[model samples]
Target: MRITIANHKGGAGKTTATVNLAAALAELDKRVLVVDMDPQANASRRLARPFDRDAPQLTASEVVRSGEEGVAAQAIAPSGWPSPYTELVSVLPARFDLDNRVSEAGTVGAVGRLRRALQGVDDEYDYTLIDAQPSLGHLTQMAFAASQRVLVVVEPEYDSVEGALRVRDFVKGYAQDLGQPDLRVLAYLVNRARRVGEHAFQLEGLADRLEGDVWTPHIPEWTAAKDAASSALPLQICGSARGPEMATLWTELAKQIIVEGAA
Candidate 1:
Protein backbone atom coordinates (compact mmCIF):
# COMPACT_ATOMS: atom_id res chain seq x y z
CA MET A 1 0.00 0.00 0.00
CA ARG A 2 1.02 3.58 -0.62
CA ILE A 3 0.22 5.87 2.30
CA THR A 4 0.94 9.56 2.76
CA ILE A 5 1.79 10.65 6.30
CA ALA A 6 0.78 14.31 6.40
CA ASN A 7 -0.45 17.31 8.38
CA HIS A 8 -1.21 20.92 7.55
CA LYS A 9 0.43 22.06 10.78
CA GLY A 10 4.17 22.20 11.31
CA GLY A 11 5.68 20.17 14.18
CA ALA A 12 2.84 17.66 14.06
CA GLY A 13 5.44 14.84 13.92
CA LYS A 14 4.83 13.78 10.34
CA THR A 15 8.46 12.86 9.65
CA THR A 16 8.75 11.24 13.04
CA ALA A 17 5.80 8.99 12.29
CA THR A 18 7.01 8.20 8.79
CA VAL A 19 10.52 7.22 9.82
CA ASN A 20 9.60 5.27 12.94
CA LEU A 21 6.71 3.54 11.25
CA ALA A 22 9.01 2.45 8.44
CA ALA A 23 11.40 1.12 11.04
CA ALA A 24 8.62 -0.76 12.78
CA LEU A 25 7.52 -2.26 9.51
CA ALA A 26 11.08 -3.29 8.80
CA GLU A 27 11.22 -5.06 12.14
CA LEU A 28 8.23 -7.07 10.97
CA ASP A 29 10.32 -8.18 7.97
CA LYS A 30 8.53 -5.92 5.54
CA ARG A 31 10.19 -4.06 2.69
CA VAL A 32 9.45 -0.35 2.85
CA LEU A 33 9.97 2.52 0.45
CA VAL A 34 10.01 5.97 2.04
CA VAL A 35 9.44 8.80 -0.40
CA ASP A 36 10.47 12.10 1.04
CA MET A 37 8.21 14.83 -0.36
CA ASP A 38 9.18 17.53 2.10
CA PRO A 39 11.86 19.90 0.91
CA GLN A 40 13.27 20.06 4.42
CA ALA A 41 14.30 16.44 3.78
CA ASN A 42 14.19 15.32 7.37
CA ALA A 43 13.17 11.79 6.32
CA SER A 44 15.93 11.65 3.72
CA ARG A 45 18.52 12.89 6.15
CA ARG A 46 17.44 10.36 8.73
CA LEU A 47 17.10 7.37 6.39
CA ALA A 48 19.45 7.97 3.47
CA ARG A 49 22.94 6.44 3.35
CA PRO A 50 25.76 8.99 3.49
CA PHE A 51 23.23 11.73 4.26
CA ASP A 52 25.84 14.37 5.07
CA ARG A 53 28.85 14.86 2.80
CA ASP A 54 28.23 12.11 0.23
CA ALA A 55 24.59 12.84 -0.61
CA PRO A 56 22.49 10.90 -3.07
CA GLN A 57 23.19 11.68 -6.69
CA LEU A 58 19.52 11.24 -7.66
CA THR A 59 16.55 12.11 -5.50
CA ALA A 60 12.79 12.60 -5.51
CA SER A 61 13.41 15.99 -7.12
CA GLU A 62 14.75 14.34 -10.24
CA VAL A 63 12.02 11.70 -10.23
CA VAL A 64 9.16 14.20 -10.01
CA ARG A 65 10.77 16.61 -12.43
CA SER A 66 11.37 13.80 -14.86
CA GLY A 67 7.69 12.80 -14.73
CA GLU A 68 8.65 9.61 -16.47
CA GLU A 69 7.18 6.22 -15.70
CA GLY A 70 9.41 4.09 -13.44
CA VAL A 71 11.98 6.88 -13.04
CA ALA A 72 11.71 6.39 -9.28
CA ALA A 73 13.65 3.13 -9.67
CA GLN A 74 16.80 5.07 -10.43
CA ALA A 75 16.53 7.29 -7.37
CA ILE A 76 15.70 4.61 -4.80
CA ALA A 77 18.58 3.69 -2.46
CA PRO A 78 19.15 1.71 0.72
CA SER A 79 18.61 3.54 3.98
CA GLY A 80 21.46 4.40 6.35
CA TRP A 81 20.35 1.97 9.02
CA PRO A 82 22.57 -1.04 9.77
CA SER A 83 22.50 -4.54 8.28
CA PRO A 84 18.98 -6.00 8.02
CA TYR A 85 17.29 -2.61 8.09
CA THR A 86 19.65 -1.32 5.42
CA GLU A 87 18.40 -4.15 3.21
CA LEU A 88 14.73 -3.81 4.20
CA VAL A 89 14.19 -0.05 3.95
CA SER A 90 14.81 2.19 0.94
CA VAL A 91 14.38 5.93 0.42
CA LEU A 92 13.75 8.29 -2.44
CA PRO A 93 15.79 11.06 -0.89
CA ALA A 94 14.91 14.74 -1.21
CA ARG A 95 16.99 17.90 -0.99
CA PHE A 96 16.19 21.59 -0.48
CA ASP A 97 15.78 22.11 -4.21
CA LEU A 98 12.79 19.75 -4.24
CA ASP A 99 10.72 22.80 -3.35
CA ASN A 100 11.24 24.01 -6.91
CA ARG A 101 8.46 21.69 -8.12
CA VAL A 102 5.94 24.09 -6.54
CA SER A 103 6.53 26.54 -9.37
CA GLU A 104 5.38 23.98 -11.94
CA ALA A 105 1.99 23.44 -10.31
CA GLY A 106 0.30 25.50 -12.98
CA THR A 107 1.46 23.26 -15.78
CA VAL A 108 -0.91 20.74 -17.27
CA GLY A 109 -0.67 17.31 -15.63
CA ALA A 110 1.75 18.68 -13.05
CA VAL A 111 -0.15 17.21 -10.14
CA GLY A 112 0.26 13.71 -11.56
CA ARG A 113 3.99 13.92 -12.08
CA LEU A 114 5.01 12.02 -8.99
CA ARG A 115 2.41 9.37 -9.56
CA ARG A 116 3.63 8.85 -13.08
CA ALA A 117 7.22 8.69 -11.94
CA LEU A 118 6.41 5.97 -9.42
CA GLN A 119 4.46 3.68 -11.69
CA GLY A 120 5.77 0.09 -11.63
CA VAL A 121 8.61 1.16 -9.34
CA ASP A 122 7.27 0.00 -5.98
CA ASP A 123 6.06 -3.48 -6.78
CA GLU A 124 8.73 -5.14 -4.67
CA TYR A 125 8.03 -3.15 -1.54
CA ASP A 126 5.34 -4.10 0.94
CA TYR A 127 4.51 -0.46 1.61
CA THR A 128 5.40 2.99 0.27
CA LEU A 129 5.14 5.83 2.78
CA ILE A 130 5.23 9.38 1.46
CA ASP A 131 6.10 12.06 4.00
CA ALA A 132 4.46 15.30 2.93
CA GLN A 133 5.40 18.80 3.99
CA PRO A 134 3.27 20.68 6.51
CA SER A 135 0.88 22.17 3.99
CA LEU A 136 -1.71 21.37 1.33
CA GLY A 137 0.40 22.93 -1.41
CA HIS A 138 1.54 21.67 -4.80
CA LEU A 139 4.27 19.44 -3.39
CA THR A 140 1.81 17.87 -1.00
CA GLN A 141 -0.67 17.48 -3.84
CA MET A 142 1.88 15.48 -5.75
CA ALA A 143 2.45 13.30 -2.71
CA PHE A 144 -1.28 12.81 -2.31
CA ALA A 145 -1.58 12.04 -5.98
CA ALA A 146 0.97 9.26 -5.60
CA SER A 147 -0.69 7.74 -2.56
CA GLN A 148 -3.54 5.30 -2.12
CA ARG A 149 -4.43 6.58 1.34
CA VAL A 150 -3.40 9.17 3.94
CA LEU A 151 -2.45 8.82 7.56
CA VAL A 152 -3.00 12.21 9.14
CA VAL A 153 -0.79 12.99 12.15
CA VAL A 154 -1.58 15.63 14.76
CA GLU A 155 -0.66 16.70 18.25
CA PRO A 156 -3.54 16.37 20.70
CA GLU A 157 -4.34 20.09 20.84
CA TYR A 158 -6.67 22.67 19.35
CA ASP A 159 -4.67 23.92 16.36
CA SER A 160 -3.42 20.43 15.58
CA VAL A 161 -6.92 18.97 15.74
CA GLU A 162 -8.13 21.72 13.43
CA GLY A 163 -5.29 20.99 11.06
CA ALA A 164 -6.16 17.28 10.96
CA LEU A 165 -9.78 18.11 10.19
CA ARG A 166 -8.67 20.43 7.43
CA VAL A 167 -6.61 17.64 5.91
CA ARG A 168 -9.57 15.26 6.18
CA ASP A 169 -11.94 17.64 4.45
CA PHE A 170 -9.43 18.74 1.86
CA VAL A 171 -8.62 15.17 0.84
CA LYS A 172 -12.30 14.42 0.40
CA GLY A 173 -12.75 17.22 -2.12
CA TYR A 174 -9.32 17.44 -3.67
CA ALA A 175 -8.95 13.74 -4.36
CA GLN A 176 -11.87 13.89 -6.72
CA ASP A 177 -10.40 16.95 -8.41
CA LEU A 178 -7.11 15.11 -8.76
CA GLY A 179 -9.00 12.22 -10.39
CA GLN A 180 -8.19 9.96 -7.47
CA PRO A 181 -11.71 9.55 -6.19
CA ASP A 182 -10.74 6.53 -4.10
CA LEU A 183 -8.04 8.34 -2.15
CA ARG A 184 -9.14 8.95 1.44
CA VAL A 185 -7.89 9.52 4.97
CA LEU A 186 -7.23 5.97 6.22
CA ALA A 187 -6.67 7.04 9.83
CA TYR A 188 -5.66 9.84 12.20
CA LEU A 189 -2.61 9.27 14.42
CA VAL A 190 -2.33 11.32 17.58
CA ASN A 191 1.34 12.16 18.04
CA ARG A 192 3.08 13.81 20.98
CA ALA A 193 0.09 13.10 23.20
CA ARG A 194 0.25 13.93 26.87
CA ARG A 195 -1.58 13.22 30.12
CA VAL A 196 -2.75 16.78 30.60
CA GLY A 197 -6.43 17.68 30.95
CA GLU A 198 -6.48 19.63 27.68
CA HIS A 199 -4.93 16.73 25.83
CA ALA A 200 -7.51 14.38 27.32
CA PHE A 201 -10.31 16.63 26.17
CA GLN A 202 -8.90 17.02 22.69
CA LEU A 203 -8.31 13.28 22.35
CA GLU A 204 -11.90 12.61 23.34
CA GLY A 205 -13.13 15.33 21.02
CA LEU A 206 -11.07 14.03 18.11
CA ALA A 207 -12.36 10.52 18.67
CA ASP A 208 -15.96 11.73 18.78
CA ARG A 209 -15.38 13.86 15.72
CA LEU A 210 -13.69 11.21 13.55
CA GLU A 211 -15.31 8.13 15.03
CA GLY A 212 -13.56 4.90 14.05
CA ASP A 213 -10.91 6.68 12.04
CA VAL A 214 -8.92 7.75 15.10
CA TRP A 215 -6.22 5.21 15.85
CA THR A 216 -5.94 3.85 19.35
CA PRO A 217 -2.79 3.97 21.55
CA HIS A 218 -1.76 7.52 20.84
CA ILE A 219 1.99 8.20 20.51
CA PRO A 220 3.23 9.90 23.68
CA GLU A 221 5.37 12.99 23.98
CA TRP A 222 8.82 11.54 24.66
CA THR A 223 12.42 12.59 24.50
CA ALA A 224 13.22 9.25 22.87
CA ALA A 225 11.71 10.39 19.60
CA LYS A 226 13.98 13.42 19.48
CA ASP A 227 16.99 11.37 20.41
CA ALA A 228 16.24 8.76 17.76
CA ALA A 229 15.90 11.36 15.02
CA SER A 230 18.98 13.31 16.06
CA SER A 231 21.06 10.17 16.30
CA ALA A 232 19.78 8.87 12.93
CA LEU A 233 18.64 5.61 14.52
CA PRO A 234 15.33 3.81 14.79
CA LEU A 235 13.44 3.94 18.05
CA GLN A 236 14.13 0.23 18.47
CA ILE A 237 17.87 0.92 18.71
CA CYS A 238 18.05 4.53 19.88
CA GLY A 239 19.36 3.36 23.30
CA SER A 240 17.16 5.83 25.18
CA ALA A 241 15.41 4.46 28.25
CA ARG A 242 11.93 4.76 26.75
CA GLY A 243 13.00 3.94 23.20
CA PRO A 244 11.76 0.33 23.36
CA GLU A 245 8.36 1.47 24.63
CA MET A 246 8.04 3.89 21.74
CA ALA A 247 9.26 1.25 19.32
CA THR A 248 6.60 -1.16 20.58
CA LEU A 249 3.91 1.45 19.97
CA TRP A 250 5.06 1.95 16.40
CA THR A 251 5.29 -1.81 15.82
CA GLU A 252 1.71 -2.23 16.96
CA LEU A 253 0.66 0.57 14.66
CA ALA A 254 2.50 -1.09 11.79
CA LYS A 255 0.63 -4.33 12.43
CA GLN A 256 -2.63 -2.41 12.32
CA ILE A 257 -1.60 -0.85 9.00
CA ILE A 258 -0.77 -4.27 7.60
CA VAL A 259 -4.17 -5.60 8.58
CA GLU A 260 -6.01 -2.60 7.20
CA GLY A 261 -4.08 -2.65 3.97
CA ALA A 262 -4.95 -6.29 3.51
CA ALA A 263 -8.60 -5.47 4.11
Candidate 2:
Protein backbone atom coordinates (compact mmCIF):
# COMPACT_ATOMS: atom_id res chain seq x y z
CA MET A 1 0.00 0.00 0.00
CA ARG A 2 1.18 3.49 -0.85
CA ILE A 3 0.20 6.29 1.54
CA THR A 4 1.10 9.88 0.72
CA ILE A 5 0.86 12.28 3.64
CA ALA A 6 0.43 15.84 2.37
CA ASN A 7 -0.78 19.34 3.20
CA HIS A 8 -0.31 22.48 1.14
CA LYS A 9 0.16 24.63 4.23
CA GLY A 10 3.40 24.43 6.19
CA GLY A 11 3.55 23.41 9.88
CA ALA A 12 0.63 21.04 9.55
CA GLY A 13 2.84 18.19 10.91
CA LYS A 14 3.30 16.52 7.52
CA THR A 15 6.95 15.59 8.01
CA THR A 16 6.46 14.58 11.64
CA ALA A 17 3.55 12.38 10.73
CA THR A 18 5.47 10.87 7.83
CA VAL A 19 8.51 9.98 9.96
CA ASN A 20 6.65 8.74 13.02
CA LEU A 21 4.08 6.73 11.12
CA ALA A 22 6.71 5.15 8.93
CA ALA A 23 8.60 4.20 12.07
CA ALA A 24 5.47 2.87 13.72
CA LEU A 25 4.59 0.72 10.71
CA ALA A 26 8.13 -0.56 10.48
CA GLU A 27 8.01 -1.45 14.15
CA LEU A 28 5.13 -3.77 13.30
CA ASP A 29 7.53 -5.73 11.11
CA LYS A 30 6.19 -4.28 7.89
CA ARG A 31 8.70 -3.52 5.18
CA VAL A 32 8.35 0.22 4.65
CA LEU A 33 9.95 2.59 2.17
CA VAL A 34 9.70 6.32 2.75
CA VAL A 35 10.13 8.45 -0.34
CA ASP A 36 11.12 11.99 0.56
CA MET A 37 9.47 13.78 -2.32
CA ASP A 38 10.01 17.16 -0.67
CA PRO A 39 13.01 19.21 -1.70
CA GLN A 40 13.32 20.56 1.83
CA ALA A 41 15.11 17.30 2.64
CA ASN A 42 13.87 17.43 6.21
CA ALA A 43 12.97 13.75 6.21
CA SER A 44 16.24 12.75 4.60
CA ARG A 45 18.31 14.70 7.08
CA ARG A 46 16.28 13.37 9.99
CA LEU A 47 16.59 9.72 8.95
CA ALA A 48 19.98 9.55 7.36
CA ARG A 49 23.48 11.04 7.58
CA PRO A 50 23.65 14.74 6.61
CA PHE A 51 23.21 13.91 2.91
CA ASP A 52 26.09 13.73 0.39
CA ARG A 53 27.83 17.10 0.50
CA ASP A 54 28.61 17.49 -3.20
CA ALA A 55 26.76 14.57 -4.77
CA PRO A 56 23.45 15.51 -6.38
CA GLN A 57 23.01 11.83 -7.31
CA LEU A 58 22.31 10.95 -3.63
CA THR A 59 18.55 11.41 -3.94
CA ALA A 60 15.28 10.37 -5.55
CA SER A 61 16.01 12.85 -8.35
CA GLU A 62 18.41 10.26 -9.75
CA VAL A 63 15.60 7.73 -9.91
CA VAL A 64 12.67 9.95 -10.85
CA ARG A 65 14.60 11.82 -13.49
CA SER A 66 16.79 8.99 -14.72
CA GLY A 67 14.18 6.25 -14.80
CA GLU A 68 15.69 4.13 -11.99
CA GLU A 69 19.15 4.18 -13.53
CA GLY A 70 20.91 4.17 -10.14
CA VAL A 71 18.12 3.64 -7.58
CA ALA A 72 18.56 -0.02 -6.66
CA ALA A 73 22.06 0.42 -5.23
CA GLN A 74 21.51 3.61 -3.26
CA ALA A 75 22.52 2.89 0.37
CA ILE A 76 20.10 4.51 2.86
CA ALA A 77 21.96 4.96 6.14
CA PRO A 78 19.82 4.95 9.25
CA SER A 79 19.62 8.01 11.50
CA GLY A 80 21.45 6.21 14.39
CA TRP A 81 18.15 5.57 16.18
CA PRO A 82 16.81 2.15 17.14
CA SER A 83 15.93 0.20 14.03
CA PRO A 84 12.31 -0.69 13.54
CA TYR A 85 11.63 -4.42 13.88
CA THR A 86 11.43 -4.74 10.12
CA GLU A 87 14.95 -3.43 9.71
CA LEU A 88 13.83 -3.13 6.13
CA VAL A 89 12.57 0.42 6.18
CA SER A 90 14.57 2.61 3.83
CA VAL A 91 14.33 6.24 2.76
CA LEU A 92 15.14 7.69 -0.64
CA PRO A 93 16.96 10.82 0.46
CA ALA A 94 16.46 14.34 -1.00
CA ARG A 95 18.32 17.62 -1.06
CA PHE A 96 17.70 21.32 -1.70
CA ASP A 97 19.08 20.96 -5.23
CA LEU A 98 16.03 18.79 -5.95
CA ASP A 99 14.05 22.02 -5.93
CA ASN A 100 15.94 23.27 -8.98
CA ARG A 101 15.32 20.00 -10.80
CA VAL A 102 11.63 20.13 -9.90
CA SER A 103 11.42 23.68 -11.18
CA GLU A 104 13.17 22.71 -14.36
CA ALA A 105 10.67 19.93 -14.99
CA GLY A 106 7.93 22.58 -15.29
CA THR A 107 4.23 21.74 -15.18
CA VAL A 108 3.79 19.42 -18.15
CA GLY A 109 5.20 15.99 -17.24
CA ALA A 110 6.61 16.74 -13.82
CA VAL A 111 3.68 15.28 -11.92
CA GLY A 112 3.79 12.04 -13.89
CA ARG A 113 7.51 11.40 -13.52
CA LEU A 114 7.36 10.09 -9.94
CA ARG A 115 4.52 7.74 -10.73
CA ARG A 116 6.42 6.30 -13.66
CA ALA A 117 9.59 5.96 -11.62
CA LEU A 118 8.00 3.93 -8.78
CA GLN A 119 5.99 1.68 -11.08
CA GLY A 120 7.67 -1.74 -10.72
CA VAL A 121 9.12 -0.96 -7.28
CA ASP A 122 5.77 -0.59 -5.52
CA ASP A 123 5.47 -4.30 -4.88
CA GLU A 124 8.93 -4.54 -3.32
CA TYR A 125 7.80 -3.08 0.00
CA ASP A 126 4.75 -3.68 2.14
CA TYR A 127 4.10 0.03 2.43
CA THR A 128 5.41 3.23 0.83
CA LEU A 129 5.05 6.56 2.65
CA ILE A 130 5.75 9.69 0.66
CA ASP A 131 6.44 12.97 2.45
CA ALA A 132 5.49 15.63 -0.09
CA GLN A 133 6.41 19.29 -0.23
CA PRO A 134 3.99 21.81 1.21
CA SER A 135 2.53 23.14 -2.01
CA LEU A 136 0.18 22.24 -4.85
CA GLY A 137 3.11 21.92 -7.22
CA HIS A 138 3.89 19.24 -9.79
CA LEU A 139 5.73 17.13 -7.20
CA THR A 140 2.70 17.07 -4.90
CA GLN A 141 0.53 16.08 -7.87
CA MET A 142 2.95 13.32 -8.68
CA ALA A 143 2.69 12.08 -5.10
CA PHE A 144 -1.07 11.99 -5.48
CA ALA A 145 -0.66 10.00 -8.65
CA ALA A 146 1.73 7.50 -7.04
CA SER A 147 -0.23 6.94 -3.84
CA GLN A 148 -3.15 4.60 -3.43
CA ARG A 149 -4.42 6.59 -0.46
CA VAL A 150 -4.06 10.35 0.04
CA LEU A 151 -3.90 11.24 3.75
CA VAL A 152 -4.38 14.93 4.41
CA VAL A 153 -2.93 16.24 7.68
CA VAL A 154 -4.84 19.26 8.93
CA GLU A 155 -4.49 21.24 12.11
CA PRO A 156 -7.67 22.50 13.80
CA GLU A 157 -7.85 26.04 12.46
CA TYR A 158 -9.64 28.07 9.85
CA ASP A 159 -6.69 28.35 7.46
CA SER A 160 -5.69 24.75 7.92
CA VAL A 161 -9.23 23.57 7.35
CA GLU A 162 -9.49 25.71 4.26
CA GLY A 163 -6.14 24.44 2.94
CA ALA A 164 -7.24 20.85 3.51
CA LEU A 165 -10.26 21.41 1.34
CA ARG A 166 -8.12 22.88 -1.41
CA VAL A 167 -5.78 19.88 -1.24
CA ARG A 168 -8.69 17.48 -1.49
CA ASP A 169 -9.97 19.37 -4.50
CA PHE A 170 -6.52 19.39 -6.05
CA VAL A 171 -6.39 15.60 -5.90
CA LYS A 172 -9.81 15.30 -7.48
CA GLY A 173 -9.19 17.84 -10.20
CA TYR A 174 -5.71 16.61 -11.00
CA ALA A 175 -6.95 13.06 -11.39
CA GLN A 176 -9.68 14.30 -13.70
CA ASP A 177 -7.13 16.23 -15.71
CA LEU A 178 -5.02 13.10 -16.02
CA GLY A 179 -8.03 10.96 -16.89
CA GLN A 180 -7.60 8.85 -13.75
CA PRO A 181 -11.13 8.25 -12.52
CA ASP A 182 -10.28 6.17 -9.45
CA LEU A 183 -8.31 8.38 -7.12
CA ARG A 184 -9.26 8.13 -3.41
CA VAL A 185 -9.14 10.21 -0.24
CA LEU A 186 -8.06 7.92 2.59
CA ALA A 187 -8.79 10.33 5.44
CA TYR A 188 -8.15 13.77 6.89
CA LEU A 189 -6.02 13.57 10.06
CA VAL A 190 -6.52 16.28 12.66
CA ASN A 191 -3.01 16.99 13.92
CA ARG A 192 -1.98 18.94 17.00
CA ALA A 193 -5.55 18.89 18.26
CA ARG A 194 -6.05 20.25 21.72
CA ARG A 195 -8.50 19.62 24.55
CA VAL A 196 -9.75 23.19 24.38
CA GLY A 197 -12.80 25.10 23.30
CA GLU A 198 -11.84 26.48 19.91
CA HIS A 199 -10.14 23.29 18.80
CA ALA A 200 -13.17 21.21 19.67
CA PHE A 201 -15.49 23.78 18.12
CA GLN A 202 -13.56 23.86 14.86
CA LEU A 203 -13.29 20.09 14.74
CA GLU A 204 -17.03 19.75 15.19
CA GLY A 205 -17.60 22.10 12.29
CA LEU A 206 -15.03 20.33 10.12
CA ALA A 207 -16.46 16.95 10.99
CA ASP A 208 -19.90 18.02 9.86
CA ARG A 209 -18.46 19.56 6.73
CA LEU A 210 -16.09 16.74 5.78
CA GLU A 211 -18.31 14.00 7.22
CA GLY A 212 -17.15 10.39 6.72
CA ASP A 213 -13.82 11.38 5.29
CA VAL A 214 -12.49 12.76 8.61
CA TRP A 215 -10.61 10.41 10.92
CA THR A 216 -12.04 10.82 14.44
CA PRO A 217 -8.91 9.97 16.43
CA HIS A 218 -6.91 13.19 16.40
CA ILE A 219 -3.31 13.75 17.58
CA PRO A 220 -2.76 16.09 20.48
CA GLU A 221 0.13 18.52 20.75
CA TRP A 222 3.11 16.90 22.47
CA THR A 223 6.38 18.46 23.56
CA ALA A 224 8.22 15.21 23.08
CA ALA A 225 7.79 15.68 19.35
CA LYS A 226 10.06 18.69 19.60
CA ASP A 227 12.44 16.99 22.01
CA ALA A 228 12.75 14.03 19.69
CA ALA A 229 13.77 16.26 16.82
CA SER A 230 16.17 18.29 18.96
CA SER A 231 17.80 15.10 20.19
CA ALA A 232 18.02 13.77 16.64
CA LEU A 233 15.97 10.76 17.71
CA PRO A 234 12.81 9.22 16.42
CA LEU A 235 9.79 9.58 18.67
CA GLN A 236 9.65 5.81 18.93
CA ILE A 237 12.79 5.99 21.02
CA CYS A 238 11.93 9.05 23.08
CA GLY A 239 9.72 7.31 25.68
CA SER A 240 8.46 10.68 26.87
CA ALA A 241 5.34 11.17 28.96
CA ARG A 242 3.30 11.79 25.84
CA GLY A 243 4.77 8.69 24.20
CA PRO A 244 1.65 6.64 24.94
CA GLU A 245 -0.55 9.29 23.35
CA MET A 246 1.56 9.43 20.23
CA ALA A 247 1.68 5.64 20.15
CA THR A 248 -2.10 5.51 20.30
CA LEU A 249 -2.32 7.83 17.35
CA TRP A 250 0.10 5.70 15.35
CA THR A 251 -1.66 2.45 16.21
CA GLU A 252 -5.01 3.90 15.20
CA LEU A 253 -3.53 5.31 12.05
CA ALA A 254 -1.94 1.98 11.18
CA LYS A 255 -5.23 0.18 11.62
CA GLN A 256 -6.85 2.75 9.40
CA ILE A 257 -4.20 2.39 6.74
CA ILE A 258 -3.50 -1.33 6.91
CA VAL A 259 -6.57 -3.08 8.29
CA GLU A 260 -9.23 -1.03 6.61
CA GLY A 261 -7.23 -0.59 3.44
CA ALA A 262 -8.62 2.93 3.26
CA ALA A 263 -7.31 3.42 -0.24
**Best-fitting candidate, measured by lDDT?**
1
lDDT by residue for model 1 (147-260), tens: 889999989889988888889888988998876888988899989999999998988768678553788778999999999998889988889999999999999889989998
lDDT of 2 at 46: 64
Q: What is the C-alpha lDDT of each candidate?
A: 0.90, 0.72
The TM-score, computed over Cα atoms with residue i paired to residue i, of candidate 1 is 0.97
lDDT of 2 at 71: 42
Which candidate comes out best when scored by TM-score?
Answer: 1
The TM-score obtained by model 2 is: 0.88
TM-score of each: 0.97, 0.88
Q: Model 2 misses residue 258 by how many Å?
A: 0.6
Candidate 1: stretches off by over 4 Å: 48-56
